[model samples]
Target: MEERPNNDTTISTDEINVLLGKLKFSEEESVQIMSTNDGKNVKGFESWAVGKIMATEHPNREAMYRVFKSLWYTKEEVDFVALKEGAVIVKFGCLEDRSRILKLMPWLFDKCLFSMVPFVKGKNIASYEFGLSPFWLRVYNIPIELMDRQLVVAVGNAIGELVAIDWKDRNGAWTEFMRLKVKIDISKPLRRIVKLVSRYGGETIEVIKYERLPDFCYMCGLIGHTFKNCKDNREGAGINDSNAQYGSWMRAPFVNPNQERNMRRNGVEIVKTTITANEDKEESQTNSRDESGQSAQKGNEKEVKKARYRHHLWKKEVISLYMTAWDGLSIRGSA
Candidate 1:
């Protein structure tokens, strides 16, 4: 071949330094500034909300848009724009609509939590963090007397930020469990229990249950993924249902209190009818046996007393049913 120049020849250190030194920067080119009036360009986005759906798999943007539009029911039109990594930006038609949506925080889509925060001016949509999410926790094992605002606040703050307390019919009425609206850090493992210490130095372990809870890792107790896909579980020895710390117990059961009330009312009526029928049958038997002897009369008295005792037990059972219905009411308070 004929002599050819080596195109792959490396540049020497001194030659590179000389080439770099040839470049110059003027004072005017040192820094670039924008006008202060740039703020007005993004003023319209002040009422916007930016959020992300906390799910391992990306959510269906179109389905989510439809679901939120239907669920919000805003008087004015609302807009949704899907972004990368399950992130979404919402534009409300009016300030009222924006405020209403934020008030209903911790919304769910296909049972996955959609955590959101108010959009800030000049802030990048991806910069917003969705670490905190609001959840309604039904605290069990708390005494009736201890189900006060102070106790709820304390317990709520222990798990996360105390958003609000669901004081649904809590005016001196007993409930199966106290309901608290807490802003929890979903980045960490969900708190399964809280220990309470009385002023007398007595300790009580209270079980925490979440209402409308989404998918979570049973092995690691973290939200967003299940035990089968948990990274921590994969990195260590395998875990199964028997050895997992968290289970289905973390999710609270959904019960419609109104429906429960109606059912219990019908139950009470049925018990009343049964008691009436039993009493009528006993009276007829006693009348038939009246002419038998004094022994028969005494036996009827014993039967009457037994019937009365049974009636008393039924009344107590009716009361128990009513109480149970009220205690299982849905935690409607949100913030």
Candidate 2:
């Protein structure tokens, strides 16, 4: 007999299951998850014959191969490699297997949903997409004066594709504004150029490679796709090119006029605390080593203690800020 969840309980079984479902795939566990290859040194299809399969949870290699095996009606007919980001690269024994998978489009195996797309060889992941090329450009010590639309456009044009800026400090009401988003190419080899030559020359721009990029759909208020490709409205209220403009929040600058002053005050406090903590840590380590020869154990203990304290404080502050922001957003939404 199953006991029903009591209303007074903090978390129900369903909630626990939901959290468990979102658990990230362990790299250690996935290291040994490779499909069997029958002594073939080279890939058969190369670029034109691979499929990129995405899922919420990383599928087991044997289970993934089984999906194809069932489809192809063979015992060991498919080979696959799992990516770190829960995506899988499935190489079929023949072009016919590839075609059949593509024809089926969306796939389901062992109660897990999956999205399948073609894997183009030689070209990167960004090249397969319809919109602009994706990349993350980090500007160091950007002059607060130049953080405007003009700067965004200039830096964007300098890169291959000018998608969107990636910073948000609300200058106005918090109601409608959302986080900034940009496109990113997964396949292209990262190119990091130190100097960004603008009207303000000699500014150093750092390009860091990230596993994923910003994906927000303004049209449908979704996260995976952009507004252009959103299928939220399949009927008469379709979004097309001419009408595909930015929302009200996107059109206006996010920064409040007084944000710089507030940021300066907060930055000063955070920097001072961080510096003080670092200095204290160094002093403690030095004193520990001087007093006792075994500083390693003492140092580890101190680090763990410091990390926990900092994390607790940080979490509290974040929760406070989030609540404050949420209230503001609620008021604005009502208006």
Candidate 3:
């Protein structure tokens, strides 16, 4: 059997370095391998043979170092780690304001983005982004730049407070309800601090597994497709070309009838007034027709009563004529 090289074997610094160099040490791994007890037991590791052994699995420290140093890049390049709770952790990471995030989006795709959001839908949730966070973070498909500054601030504040409320509520409920899930919100401030230090540099994401947006089949509630394309009752159908994400295949929010009229006239108020007037006119006509029908019935009844009264009066003999005849007869008899 061939003799195995020992870790205690004495090896010259130059020989060990040569071996490490051949292994293509990353800067860090090179530092480690080189810093070992002055090449003790690193004999067989002194050259290409040594490099071949280390190359089987371990990273080439020298090679890594050369790449980083040559690029003149700093540890900041890879300093990002994922939030512990993933999306929920994102709920906690807040910015000084929300607009700050909007401004950072383009750069976020290019670099790392951090910060907390406290409130989401009245629940306290927090989130963090790996440098790899995508464009889905855009608010309503409208660039933060296009939105009113006040709205951006409001949305940010609201998101922050939302997560806070939910987190607190869940915590409270969890304490009372033993069966309630125990939550995990991992934030390694210490890790960040340590990485920020001179020792362990920041590291970029080594991997990503993506899950595409869902297809729950709702039109109006900001899901899958447009209402015109909806399979449900076609009550909310119409083309909404004016949508902010008009051509985007991701989401389709079609404008309904009233909206279409508004677009046709280029005025929302017009549609509202027209619809209002039409409804009011129809209601009034219905009320008036009912009233007129009642009045006509009453008129007919009055005419019938008058006709009957006249007939009765016509049927009555004239008492005055009889009286006249009697008086004349009396006068003749007397003569």
Query: How do all models score by TM-score?
Result: 0.63, 0.24, 0.15
Give the per-residue lDDT digits (tens) of candidate 3, residues 9-66: 6555567778976786577765643345554332222210000110112233333323
Runs in model 3 deviating more than 4 A are: 1-78, 88-102, 106-218, 221-335
Question: For residues 1-335, could you state the per-residue lDDT of candidate 2 as single tens digits?
Answer: 99887775555456778998888869885577667965343336442243433222334556555544544442226667764334466676655556544432233343233445556655543334422233334443444555565555554454444443333333431122212222433233233332455575556553322212223454643334455565565666756556744332322223332453332111111222333457667666677787787775566556545654553454333333332332243233233
Task: Report per-prediction Cα RMSD to one decimal.
Answer: 21.0, 22.5, 41.8
How many clashes does each candidate structure show, in the order listed? 0, 5, 59
lDDT of 1 by residue, 1-335 (tens): 79987785656556778987898869987788866764454325877888887878545667767656755667678888877566788888776677667755667665567888988877766578899887777899887778775687678778897765545432334367777667889999999999999999989999999977887888888888887777786565876678879999888875564543432221111222333556677666677677675665676556555554543454443334433433322221110
**Residue 291 of model 3: what lDDT?**
71
Give the Å shift of residue 86 in candidate 2: 2.5
- TM-score: the better of candidates 1 and 2: 1
Clash pairs (backbone) in predicted model 2: 134-183, 134-184, 171-254, 171-255, 171-256
Model 2 gets an lDDT of 0.42
Quote the lDDT for 92 in model 2: 67
**CA lDDT, candidate 2, residue 213:** 26
Candidate 2 versus truth, CA RMSD in Å, comes to 22.5
The global C-alpha lDDT for each of the candidates, from Candidate 1 onward, is 0.68, 0.42, 0.27
How displaced is residue 131 in candidate 2, in Å? 12
By lDDT rank, best first, the candidates go 1, 2, 3
